[model samples]
Target: MLHAFRLAAVICAVLPCAALAHPHVFVDVSLTLRYDAQGRLAGIDEVWAYDELYSLLMLTEAGVEGTVDPGQMAALRGLDANWDPLNGGRLTVEPPDGPAVLAQPRHLSTQWQGNRMVTRRRHALSPPVAGDGPVFVRVYDPTYYVDFAMPSQVVIQGRAGCQASLQSGQTRGQDDAYAATLRAALAQELDRAGPDDVQVDIGAVGADSIAVSCGR
Candidate 1:
């Protein structure tokens, strides 16, 4: 997974004029905020629908283009296991003092939706938190490698009178300029930065984020 990410980063950096202009892959995401019986925040349910091109590529690579065999199932599981949605700091949850980092996702699975791959997973907060106050959640690919957007309003569960809405991020020109700068910087740091060192600025790309308010 790290290798793949680095390779994509390099490709985008090296061909910023062409490749960076339009992302190679796209995903539509929806987040469902879950709460425990006590009304404390429990986890976030994520659903990602990948683009047809990327889905085909994944299926080809997995050698499960025609059937859903055992090997195909295992390959899908491998993809889920290798994917750390927040590893690139693509997600952020705001709390009182600071932001909350999410734990490894649970119940991650991928299925075919026509020609696309729809992935579902649950991400638990490191420490359970109260559903009160305004909780902000942002999901974006900070490196601008792949475009992610929410096609629908976020769903809130277990919290009464909770409402969520999406906020658009930077303007097209601003986002393009930012992507260009990031590509140039990444190109220079490709050799110096290890996989773990590669980071994305979630805030920079968090123009389209979900803001949740739990009314009393």
Candidate 2:
């Protein structure tokens, strides 16, 4: 997914304003908040299902047709093992002082789910933060290079008293502003002989965030 995001970022950085408004790839994400036996927040399980178009592109890049062969599947697994999406600054975990960074992921795997590519991974929360109150988590590419949606409901595993809710990010006006900013950045990059120094925080455009509350 990060690979696709980077490719889209480059396209947005070099393309004209007309082409910078839309996302090149789309993913539907389902996040599960996991708790340890002692009821402490241990980790999160994420499933990212790629859109058919993007899945086809990935298959083509992997030199596979129809179902992936064993070699192709191994290659996909290797890609997931090497790419650490949690540290990409796209996922944010709020814990009062600031956003908390998660630890390394486990049980990371990717496979073809029907015609789409689906990636599943478990990200261990650093320091094993307790879920005693509301925890805000947002999964999105700050650049908005790849649009992410939660089509399925968020699940809380092993905690009967826990509940999760979705909060929509970005109004129509904010989305428009985000598109304009991307266009401007891309244009500026094209004009400069060297790399442009401008930094765009596309996070302001809004994000599809989730709030998890555990009642002890």
Candidate 3:
């Protein structure tokens, strides 16, 4: 698990933009949240799942590891990482620097509102370098995440449902509208948070990255 954390920390750093290439993608993603036994997020886990893969990618590119599992690995885009001495912390990154870093509110939590958790979670800040997100990355673990609308719903490769998730309710042309509504609700929730209570960043990196490191 520690190895996976180290690997993911590295991957999110290297692939700052997220590299989900398949439509019917099955990513084993997870989050390292500061939670209790009942399963509640109280913190964040930057590095998880992708430790070996990242090391392998480095080896494959360097010609050290001969014959890599192309099927086992997906392409990563941007996952930059940065180490902050002032905060004594490291962060994964993509663009616009990184996500805001703050603390999760003592009572802040995600509440299910209809099909999704319409409430904002006081998630940990994204790493200055290798951060995470898709609506506040690393806030919730795989079990808590509802992103996988159809883990078994396989569509054609490259098609919306086949490779990537089509959002919570984006089946029809109104996907745009649905997304807007969700974002609006999220923004409202985030708006009430204190700057020191949470961090904000971007990187719609698919659940694949999140899935890989659920327990690590």
Q: Estimate the TM-score of every prediction.
A: 0.75, 0.75, 0.23
Cα lDDT for residue 76, candidate 3? 22
Q: Comparing candidate 2 with candidate 3, which one achieves the higher lDDT?
A: 2
Task: Go through the candidates in order and give each one's C-alpha lDDT.
Answer: 0.66, 0.66, 0.28
Error of 3 at 60 (Å): 1.5
Q: What's every prediction's RMSD, in angstroms? A: 4.7, 5.1, 18.7
List the candidate numbers ranked by TM-score, top first: 2, 1, 3
Worst 10 residues of 3 by lDDT: 153-162
Query: Please, what are the lDDT tens digits per residue for candidate 3 over residues 163-203?
Result: 22322322232233323333443444446552322221111
Q: How many times do residue backbones clash in model 2?
A: 0
How much is 28 displaced in model 3, in angstroms?
Answer: 3.5
**Tens digits of lDDT, candidate 2, 1-216:** 234334545776576434554466788888888888878777888888888987887777767776676557765554331144432225567856566668766656788878888888788877666777578887766555577785337888777888778878764534565556655555555566634444444644666678778888
What is the Cα-based TM-score of model 2?
0.75
lDDT score at residue 99, model 2, on the 0-100 scale: 66
Q: Model 1 — which ten-residue stretch has the worst lDDT?
A: 80-89
Summarize candidate 1's per-residue lDDT along 125-148 as a digit string, tens digits. Answer: 878777785777876665455677
On a 0 to 100 scale, what is the lDDT of residue 48 in model 1? 79
